[model samples]
Target: MRLPGLILIVLATLVPVIWFAPLAGERDAVALFSQYLGASALILMGINQFLATRVAGIETIFGSLDRIYILHKWLGVVALVAMGLHDIIDAEMNGLRGGPLSGIAEDIGEVSLYGLLILILASVITFIPYHLWKWSHRLIGVFFLMGAFHYFFIEKPFSNFEPLGLYISAFCILGIVSYVWMSLLRPMTPRGHVYEVDLVRRVGGLTELVLLPKGRGMKHKPGQFAFLSINDGALGEEHPFTLSGAPAQDRSLRFSIKDLGDYTKRLHKTVEPGMEALVCGPYGHFSMPKGRDPQIWIGAGVGITPFLAFAESLRTADAGPVKLYYCVREQDDVPYAVELENIAEAVPNLELVIVNSAEGIRLTADRIAGDLDGDLSTAHVFFCGPVAMRKALKTDLVLKGMRASRFHFEEFEMRTGIGLRVLAAWLWDRGVYELEKRNSALRQPAE
Candidate 1:
């Protein structure tokens, strides 16, 4: 069975035994069910804590692990809900609950409140966007630990019959506690500006920002990306951008952006020299690591940005025997064309193949595969381009026997104004939403 299917099956089997414990005809039997519920809580909490802490450390490591983290959270919610029934049923079956169940209300309320807090905290941290939720999220780790203590400690005697129950509770507490320590105690450079723009220019609809770092700056492997947030918020709303500038002296950073989105369009119009831009970065697994075989870089249009950086970085050390196959629909679409030529001219190790689609130089991975004499065995291919082009290249490269692990590609950012267009249209359909929010001057508090 699939991982999710297995998880659902395990939860399905465990929930019912806990729910109907009070109907089992024996007081001790119900306590046994409560102990099982406690064990589930511990297991769920431990997994969440362990993954959350690991996610805090690095970028791509956790990016790839996000699916597991999501599953762990869903499991946590299920466990929380199931355990509530276990606790309530156990209390009533033992008659420790008072007068016509009037006393049981307070106990259930206390237990449910703890369970509800866990649900709320987990749901919020998982569902809300980072900008709106991160500040309040740090305490969730504490909440999980505190909730565990409230549970196991209240039913302390369960640990005597179910020794394993105590162990699981301890694991959950430690896991979340460990997450808090890793997230807060790590000596990472606190969220701050990575570079300041020295120049912002518009070439047609594209924007080029010449950046200078305010600090020692970032040292990243080739084929990686940084998240750029141009706001004054501590942790700004950012998008991943491949570093176009070589990491050398002067700390000069270069970024080429298309005027396609609300953010990028505003950047073209408003970005100024000396403006602060927070860059939390160097994320992605696309870097051509050492020991990589004869590789080819397949670039399409503006996706050639990282190849530009890689070329310069490699040129400084006369890096490799790799070829860069770049494709652009028009001659003018080649970003930093002059720099590309300079790098090629200076490095004998580098081969720059500019396929100008304007001249009907229809290039593809299949052609490259055939031309290379079906010897893609030692070649690692990196591509960043239009969806159609990347898809074709991947299909052809794999067909030619290139190893799957050797191919890496990045998707381009969607147009910025598209999101705003959707938002505006949605609000326009609702008079109250528009009048209370964007109908500025007319926007006011509603009764």
Candidate 2:
């Protein structure tokens, strides 16, 4: 998804090897292979650190933090694979048969490898508890530090490939420094614009947080999201949420958080007025497109939050024709239906479609096309809902003639807590539960 950033990382990892290939000097086969392995691991580690930084430019390229994290997780896995291969290759060749002092350096590398392998696996495999995963994930830089120490003191390659060694050393240092700043320094640092809770409203399974900027408020686009930490982690940890309302003249912001987990479920009662919150973002790229193409929005459950902001901003607008499909399990589950209906009625070219599955009304590509003035290919489609809903609908639309490039969606969940169970459940919901039921209905002989 983030091809440009991925390409840059690849170039950064390989360009050094290409530049220094000539000067690497003649060596035995085992020694050369060992050097290659070490260099690859070092370069990947550097790239891993760079991605972990979560800088604005990377987010811009990746389109959202969710995509950035996907890249980050995959990069870690790739780096781990490279490092594992290097370990295996070197162990088989017995290249580092150094005695005494050099053996200590080799041992350091070995220990670092095992430690990193454990930590990275723990971070990835969702079975582990969230707190444990977070702590172990932070410990990765420590192992990387050890690996750097080993790289400096190791017996091979450094004799002739001193420049390459120094380059890796710089990366290791920078990686560790970046990790420290991101995990430690930034969290501890205070913000210039602190917000106080102005109101807390509970609507169905969602809690709406209204914040009043005390000093310098964040200016953001309608569909952008922000990282909110209430009472400095009193109601659990900091989390990202999409702004539900348009930027107000008073600099007050609104966020709708659904009860997805234990921490979020207690938010309505735990949060009170006058409570101070640290709002860290205004991030994400889920917004209206540049052109005036007709927009087909598919919002499910609380995924309607961004669309709410979009509708609020349409008060005095001249955009293209718009059709919104708001899907919910039941009519009672619909949030902001009244507000959205009012906006749709007032807006000249906007049309609203409410699909309640409980009433036997479902959303499908054929249904959307039937309701539209023209073919589905003529409009741009935006979606924000359960991952399963997005995947199924997107696939169906694309199969029915919509261009893949015309579909867009953003993930609100950061995925720190995602594990095999979560993924399996998601797959089951989108796959068997939805598909099998439809298939069974279609297979009836006469109905």
Candidate 3:
């Protein structure tokens, strides 16, 4: 099942408490509702902590690590909103005398809420340095600990032994355990395999690192990604990058990284051969499908990394009738273009099309269908590009008779900002377009 279904199931499990929990006479409806929201926020915060653990096999349940991270983001957002509302709504109940520790608990709760707000703000502001943002993010668990303490000591209508109380307490335990495991215990344990970098090549904005395992290497399929952490102090943080080469027997790995961020820019300049590295995955579900259906692969800019793995895999594997479109600004911007052309020449079932957008050769749905002789109805479309391009192409392809289910792409952003300004501008543009359309229709003669 998808993440939304799982989230619904979680909320559904809590809904019964509203009816089953014993109440003290007739309470203020708004106050009681706010209390429930507070409870939900705490429960969701617990699940949010669990999701951050990155435990083995958990990605399978959410389809991919990308989706898991997306769910993690949304859960935090909802929990934050609920918590804010609970705080603003004033959930104090009459005749419910405070617990012995209620004063201390209330103070802790206030601190946690404010601390969480500041940390979350740091996370949402994309301009911050990655290391600083990460450090702030780690401190969030401390606030969660404070929140749990507040929940434990705060006075409420239900007794500690009551059903609702017990259920929430179980979640508190889950959150605490998850936090300990992720932030403390997990780091102490060895993870992934150690590899020594054999070569480092820089071309334009791209940096390619070739690594040979010092011990047993990770087993991975084509088009999967891994978390890479170099032992150097400057590059110690683990960052996810796609495996740009096909899996080999000697357990070697290759990563094609673009200098897009602060850490990557530092890596491009500082990383050298013989550096110790840790590789901790083979995650993601963006692999070649098993069926023999015709395929259309679209890659733009550095998004072309995965398709490199896919193309290399075709040497021994039989994937029938694949059309690969490599989109870049110009010929100079295209990485591994000659290699792809050579592969296409050697493999009869594969065809390579280079679309240079700078020269006005955009990869549109019409262009795709025209090249395929309007046989796109049966072709499965795989895309990796800017989010706007993906949305536009997907909409156009579906309108041109391609199945919506056949379109596949990963959510590429590892960290996303709220982009409120962009959203507001888009909404204003949409409103103006609607108004124009209405005016045009009204001016036309009756049919």
Q: What lDDT, from 0 to 1, does candidate 3 have?
A: 0.85
lDDT per residue as tens, model 3, 359-415: 888899998888778877788898988999999999999988899989999777877
lDDT on C-alpha atoms for all candidate structures: 0.62, 0.77, 0.85
Alpha-carbon error at 203 in model 3, in Å? Answer: 3.5
**Model 3 weakest 10-residue run by lDDT:** 16-25
Candidate 2 wrongly placed segments (more than 4 Å): 23-25, 91-101, 159-161, 331-333, 416-447
List the candidate numbers ranked by lDDT, top first. Answer: 3, 2, 1
Choose the strongest candidate by TM-score. Answer: 3
Name every residue pair that clashes in candidate 3: none
TM for every model, in the order presented, reads 0.59, 0.87, 0.91
lDDT score of residue 389 within candidate 3: 97
